[model samples]
Target: MSMAAPAFNLRTDLDAMWLLPSLKPRIANQLAGLVNTAPAWMKNERPLVSFSFDDVAKSAAHSGARLLAEHGATGTFYVSGSLVGTHSDYWINADRDDIVELIRSGHEIGCHTHGHLSIANATPERIFAETRTNTRFLRTLEPDLKIDNFAYPFGRASPGLKKRLATRFHSSRSTRAEVNHGRIDLQLLSAFPLMDRKMTPRVIDRILDRAVQTNGWAIFYTNDVALQPSPYGCSPALLAYALTAAEARGIECAPIRDALLKIGAERTF
Candidate 1:
């Protein structure tokens, strides 16, 4: 049977010019620092790493999943349910079947707001509604799916939104460029990007080495995964390098939910 077309527009508007202004993100970053929702008490014996994809693109659904699987690791894909099967100028977004397959293959599916709206700019009601809508859509694919992890759209979240996200998920990740270590905020867990322009092999190696040295958790985020990737995306080769680096350092690679479990942040799966 053919699936019904999405009730909303399918295009993504992630461009800096289209979303929040430059100064707003800076302000959001500052606000995030002030909020304390869920504090992660770190007791990690070894370094942990999670390779996650936000606003997952189809290439990530395939190549990203494959790369992780090749290394006997899995990833967490933070999906905007409304964008399933959609196409934007920069990405071919993952569809419903891809999400199902991801779960079947042992990848975690985390939540991004349905409209991909920035948590920093949205009202509480809007934030709740969008997240509810996203989970509702995902439930159609896997009725038993438990979305215990979240990512702020555009890596922006207000203080109030941070509190709300903390209450709703086991952990919520932000696009902050650092590793989560001793006494970190679970609500705004730090994640560095794996984009070509932002990270190289040496940078990845350094980060992995640091995580191992500190016995911390490093979460890497990205969008699409292809040989020729989008401007904000990481190439497959870079993704593989990250996985290899983590493995070489004896760092355990897991999805966000599993990593949280390892750190004693228990959630009902």
Candidate 2:
């Protein structure tokens, strides 16, 4: 039997405008960062970078993944099961075949909840159910898949949800726009956006440079990578530019799982 469609529409409901310069969300996110932290010490000799795609758009699964592969790198694709194979106003979601191809091609399949709901607005029960449904659906496609990473939908999180997720995932990423270094909160790992509308070569250089200087982990996240990308997505050229910049700096690019292993991230709860 096919899974039922989620009531929320990703095209409309996923907008994070409320998170911009808002005192409430800003305070909430800051407060969440202070508590329920699963701290990890990052120990590595060289800088590390990871490219991750949230929601697994068709272009991301194809063009974005291809670009990474061309660079001899792999990325983490955070999949929301309900959106798989569905069409949004901006782009189409990756189907079962695309996901299978990603797995076969050695990409990491991360979690983004089943309905793409923001954890800040979800009840505890709803959060559990969403994760369970998403994991179950993902395993149906690849029974042996090990989904150990998660990205909060819309980059929203709370202390309770963060605590709950820490038990289930090896690491959870956020849209905090910073590089991970030293002592990091694994429950809310900081990540920068690679949006076409907002990113520039200078900005990419600055972020990568900081990672190299600090010997840190730089996790860059984007959605669809196409010629004309959505506001939240980046163009193929921009994606390639970031990858090439990272490579030129002698940074090692890998999926989140592999990067974590290489960096020797150890949890200190």
Q: Each candidate: what lDDT?
A: 0.86, 0.89
Q: lDDT per residue, candidate 2, 126-182, as tens digits?
A: 875788899999999999999989999989877777888877888889998999999
* Residue-level error in angstroms, candidate 2, position 200: 0.4
lDDT of 2: 0.89
Model 1 lDDT, full chain set: 0.86
lDDT (Cα, 0-100) at 13 in candidate 1 = 37
Q: Where does the lowest 10-residue lDDT sum fall in candidate 1?
A: 9-18
Candidate topping lDDT: 2
TM-score of each: 0.89, 0.89
Off by over 4 Å in 1: 1-25, 266-269
